[model samples]
Target chain A: MTDTTVKEPVQFFVTEDPHHHDGDHGEHHHETGTMLGFWIYLMSDCLIFGILFAVYAVLGGNYAAGPAPVDLFELDMILVSTFMLLFSSITYGFAVLRMDRNDLKGTLLWLVITGGFGVAFLYLEVLEFSHLIHLGATPQASAFLSSFFFLVGTHGMHVLGGSIWLVVLLIQLSQRGLTHENKRRVMCLSLFWHFLDLIWIGVFSLVYLTGVLL
Target chain B: MSDHAKGGHGSLKSYLIGFVLSVILTVIPFWVVMGEPLDNKGVAVAIIFILGGAQMLVHIHYFLHVTIKAEQGWQAMSMGLTILLLVIVLSGSIWVMFNLEENMMPAHEQIERVRNLP
Candidate 1:
């Protein structure tokens, strides 16, 4: 039939894939494109963190006569926090793997575990900061302290954000049983959790390690 | 399914390496700052500084996977720009501050307060 003669239009099939044509396997939802969009958002998040790291590096070592990284860091506790955050990132990876398998319960369990560890890490970090303040290393005291706060504080905030993300994913997983959207959300959270772990490494290296040396 | 194959030991192995490197980096720097003189070392702190930067790359590439993808090239470009700006701000300010200290501090009583200490 000629294109002009077709009454229903040439693109009348409603979707590119046969599985989605009748809306059976698709159940009126699509995720492939959405995942790409989330990936874009992840890239943008990279830029945000780039700016923060620059701020921290520039401000680092402006110690203004207060306690510096050398005097402030306690290697033991930071080592523990590092383990928690890194492990949480790995567990979140496992969670997403389970999600891909359609094991909703397993995914939820792993995500909750990841979130719990993340919260624990944040708690310890707050306590560490409190102790630092007690010893007179407040952010306002010096440029070095300011940079230290921004660097570590930004990581702490990302952990908090990841914890909230896992919580929401839990709610969705329970309510929807690993629907496509929920799975995509879990994958995105995994990337974000791992991203925070990556930042923690930089913190461990630049701020904690280098600060102590300087 | 791609999902079932996703769980593996490789990711965990990388994580462990990253952790150990992090610990070593932390310890050496801490020791140096706490008053072990680096004067006698043949290489000085130069080796440690290079190691630390390399360790940072390990975390970024192995864990983050951000790179020069066609779609995500902005991330790398932005990161490079940020690094350039960071170096300028940090080094320039530090240089200015050191010069300021030498030229200006002797003009004030702050120096006298310390000199008069019993």
Candidate 2:
């Protein structure tokens, strides 16, 4: 009975806005569905690449008395280009990690690094192709050359497109900050970047290494 | 958003691990091709392809974060279907195109048979 003439004040914590719970829940579902849709689109893109690989596999040996892979390919130069792409992939990973941390500048810095490596890779590839053409081994010289240029050129084009996408994403990040939608976009771009890396591994191993070896 | 969207899906450690594995995988194949360490061309080719597949898995797991622990059922189902379709389409296209090429050769029996048919 000494009691408690004094009363304790109640404390409340604000977490969710109860008024918007239902609408937010539906919107979350829609967002996840869109991500799945993006995955489907990527899978379809894989089909395009798979078909190209099939074409190369069928026509890879048709040199038509032109310069073959072993004659034209410089392993050292290609290796440098391969490392450039590989390093870009890791840099892109860093950008995604920064996105996770909500660090905008870090994300942009890493993205720029990724784009730099991509540009270097493309430059070396263009140099290699020009040298081949200068050596009178253009794509029109042989089926093998045609397939090689087509498969590898298509991949390089994808990288160029990805670089442009990165620039747009940087602009988006600057304008919008780290909104949920931007995060989804970063995840999608991460998938595309790594998917390209995976495809490059295939190209290097099957197209380059095997071609040179055989 | 999933827990992954909030970050911390993997870590820098995971990315480093993947990068190291990828480099090792790449270098070994290049060494096999460049150094001629193996006399048997078939074996060298097999090794390169196997290593390629392994490196792809490493990228998928570490960089892309595609695993059983990620997301849920629909993702796995879709991935499985996509892989299945890829295998079918690639193998089918290669097989068919090669067969067509072989049939078109002058010495091929199928070519002779077709000429006689007309």
Candidate 3:
């Protein structure tokens, strides 16, 4: 007869010791609640966008016998927009780096810069949509147009949301000076902002780049 | 004015390379595909899929620092999950909708019907 020993599984718990900003973080009891909560929000946001993308793919090619992606979608404009958004994403990384260095002013400045680029990206898209509608490719024209509006519109709304978040962060920076709450907010917003940039990549490819190719 | 210059868009060379690759990739497709009236819809669809995936990876890796180690495993896991949900929703619905569109109203003729409707 062989005897086997049973072992109990270990349970992990969260702690509240703040200010672990270094990358080489040791194992702590903290649960990263701010990060965890932000992730929940991100997942919910993903679902919202997932539904919209489903709509986009479903009606995507419905040209309605109107000016399709081939006729619309200028490569030059989209390239410019892509650069602006991508650059903004990079700059936000600068802000997080500054925050880690405890440079509040520099962090705030970078966040503002990131927000500015986000604004520019949104502007370019609005202009593009206006031009398309002017050329008689309104969302009401066909399923393709409708899907285009939903996919792009959902992204544009996120940019707008991030920009607004920046303004709030600016205020918090001025008044609070990187309090723990503010720190968590900044971190979460960084994730959201960067996630938006990632989605824009999908947008640029699926809607604009491929729209041109196919 | 920051400590971590190793982070995103940290240098001129990288930005230039990313920018150039993005431009060439985007522009060449426009020039190549737009010139020809394609007889094969299947080929066009395949091209679109390939281009879309490539350009998207370029944007995510270069622009957003959604690296494998940001916040331990959190960032990567969240990103992977988001992508999975996106693909499932987008591709699955597209397939279903196209079938319905084809069986319900037919192709270019249905489009004309939509266009001519008041």
DockQ scores of all models, one per candidate: 0.17, 0.49, 0.26
- Indicate the residue-level lDDT of A2 in model 1: 22
Docking class of 3: acceptable
What are the clashing pairs of model 1?
A62-A144
- Candidate 3 chain A weakest ten by summed lDDT: A1-10
TM-score of chain B of 2: 0.79
Models sorted by lDDT, best on top: 2, 3, 1
lDDT of each: 0.64, 0.81, 0.69
TM-score of structure candidate 3: 0.71
Error of 2 at A84 (Å): 1.1
Worst 10 contiguous positions by lDDT, candidate 1 chain A: A1-10
Tens digits of per-residue lDDT for model 3 on A147-197?
898889888988998899899889978886755456667777877886786
Q: Tens digit of lDDT per residue, candidate 2, span A40-86?
A: 78778878888788889888999998888999999988899989989
Q: Write the per-residue lDDT of candidate 1 for residues B13-33, one digit (tens) a residue.
A: 665665566556545654564
The DockQ leader among the candidates is 2
What DockQ would candidate 2 receive versus the native complex?
0.49
* Higher-scoring candidate on TM-score, 1 or 2: 2
Chain B TM-scores, listed for every candidate in order, come to 0.58, 0.79, 0.68
Off by over 4 Å in 3: A1-31, B1-81, B105-118
